[model samples]
Target: MNQQQFEKMKHGQGFIAALDQSGGSTPKALAAYGVPEDSYSGEDEMFDLVHKMRTRIITSPAFNSDQIIGAILFEQTMDREIEGKYTADYLADQGIVPFLKVDKGLADQTDGVQLMKPIDNLDETLRRANERNIFGTKMRSVIHEPNESGIKEVVKQQFEIGKQIIAAGLVPIIEPEVNIHSEGKEKAEEILKEEIRKHLDQLSEDENVMLKLTIPTEANTYKQLIDHPRVVRVVALSGGYDRDKANSLLKENDGLIASFSRALADDLNANQSDKEFNTALQNAVDSIHNASVNKK
Candidate 1:
């Protein structure tokens, strides 16, 4: 990405709506949203419901407003059309940048850490994303505890992957999501911060990178990273928190914004009336936008 494009993304509304649920997680989300398991076929039903949810957000006024600056889309939904217009085109028309989730998924655990499964055909995937006018890409890996060695390996791998994406002329959202329910969350954040700095410190001055991390237990745990010269912006994932709690926590840290999936989509179901769905989306967007502005 060019410097001007990077500035637009970094300084925009900071609240990124994540609609990139993979096949494995989509079924559970559908059920949680009150879609009965036997209502339709198998994975197809799950994706269909996900498509409906994406359509709702894309059609909402709140989503078209400045409350949401960017959105992440699953591969299946990225190219789909709304009202005969491509989803990416619709988002760009509304001034909300579109991002694609490029990681395959998580792999088996090693040393208590779950590494993100590398994309098998990343070059072609990135080429398609670029052709589709995607603004960025996000990939996820998991951190279970504050193991220094494990954290270093995770950081190394993430940065290596990020380098490839950056070289492909697209921004990368490096996500090493810490399990919120794990013990010693505070210590884990400290370790994660150190590992991040270790890799960032080695980067050339022009190699700007972005991070999408789990909310830290303490407000200033990631302050150093937010201020790092090579770090463009720092964003937080909702992890397992609900919208209310997630917003509350997001406000505790300065320079942190949200890239929330479940929290952003909370309370809307396939059964809601149009008015009800719109109300839910508006309330969620308002809260998340307010939190992003109140990050201090």
Candidate 2:
């Protein structure tokens, strides 16, 4: 999008809740919530639960809180409605920007690192995002270790695709996620930061980008990025950390906000009583909200 859009997001001072897991992740999440394997047999069945989750978030006070300015939605949820309103529209009405996950999932490993599946027809995807009034998009690629060459390759590819997304008039959240449990996590982040710098350095002074990074070992590893002219925001992924630990780590980082999936919904499961679910979600939201406001 334009600088104004990015500026609005920056001013919002919040994180993104990544509720866009698809396929296996969807069922796994449901099952964790005590939904039985036999509970849902198809994509439609699984999506019904997702929609309900969105509904909960939208109608809850947490959704209206200033701690969250946007949400990342699965393609299925893009057109889905809750309470007779399109999900995206629902988010917009609440002042939360809607962003779509456009990657096709992981492809074959490249030098022991898994790259994101190619965007088969990105123009069409962007078209849908546009029509849905989505404010931005997120794509993910994985870095397994501190393999400099592999990390560089993944970052390069991410930026290449990101530029195209920017050209399409939508902000792109370039997510080159480093495995948190991988060895040499700190060094890996250093390498990834350098690679990202290469891409940012190439952008014209007027161009802007946003990053969805894994929380680094060093709290301020991304300070340079936070200060960069073309960098709008630097957000972190939970990267499978539990909600408490995720928030604890996130709070230590300066100028980094969250875009969490598992952590954001850690306590939300199918088994919880409605009251219990709301309490758990509220607590989770509070932690993330507090961390986002601590902008370092």
Candidate 3:
């Protein structure tokens, strides 16, 4: 993501950020990022994530008191592992919001099957959340993977998911992730930009989504899928290693970038290294700084 693109995104239209696998490094990394963190981690890990959220809010120049700090529990919620009744209440107690990752994503179910498959505990689980009063609910779609869909499944799923959430009165995180990881941040950004275009094709006149968990940052393939009219009310996502890239991506589009590491439960190294996450962010900031100095 670059300055021009960053300038284009609508501000305060927050993006979702992910925690890297390091159970401990998130807060320090986000502080280095100069942005607030919104996290998604396991039940045991809330201690660390909440601390990260609080510290980022207190210290970062970007902190907004009105915004939320939260996490997405895909494996736990989908598998019926969370104690939904008190979980939301518990998170609020810690100054964190909780979201149920409603999208079913996996390679085998790629085209259409994934989106149509009802959330494992859809109606009942949300009811539990509402009763307990969790901050909101988020759902995603596994649309256009290795096989792009002319079948129009993303839009179909979008309508279905949006309607359901509206009925339930939960804020929907509509993330249609084409998150095929890449070592090159620019390449990753490319893939994401295209993914954003594809997903946004579903946006209607009313444009019902509360957010797009991931928005494209790199320019590489973004233009390939660029046909949508903006439907996302806000934009954000959580991923590992892209805070700065994520920062640049959102800045270009004039949107928000919420923080998360891809899946820190698995990567012990990334979890511990603040340097890793901040490098891209630092590079991004430096680029802007250099450009500003040059302009002057």
Would you list the C-alpha lDDT of every candidate in the order shown? 0.84, 0.82, 0.43
Q: Model 2 residue 214 lDDT?
A: 89
Question: Estimated TM-score per prediction?
Answer: 0.95, 0.94, 0.50
Q: Candidate 1 vs. truth: CA RMSD?
A: 1.5
Model 2 misplacement above 4 A: 1-5
Ranked candidates (lDDT, high to low): 1, 2, 3
Instruction: Give candidate 1 misplaced runs (Cα > 4 Å).
Output: 2-5
Better of 1 and 3 by TM-score: 1
lDDT of 1 at 196: 93
- Candidate 1 local lDDT, residue 126: 88
Best by TM-score: 1
lDDT of 1 by residue, 1-296 (tens): 64555766778765888989888888777776778778868777668777887887789876864778888888888777877877777787887778899999988878667888868999998898888788788999898877777878888889999988888888888999999998967787898899899889998876778899999998868989989988878889999998889899999988898889989877787788888888988888889888987765
Give one digit per residue, the lDDT tens place, for model 2 in 1-296.
53444665776777888889887587787776667669777778777876776677667775663778888998888888867888888887777878899899998877747898878999999988888888888999988878889898899989999888888888888999988888878888899999999899999865677899988888889989878878878889989888778888888887788888888877786667778877888888888988877743
Candidate 3 deviant stretches above 4 angstroms: 1-68, 74-85, 93-96, 107-116, 143-151, 180-207, 217-232, 238-241, 263-296
> Candidate 2: how large is its RMSD?
1.7
For candidate 2, give the lDDT: 0.82
Worst lDDT 10-window in candidate 3: 1-10
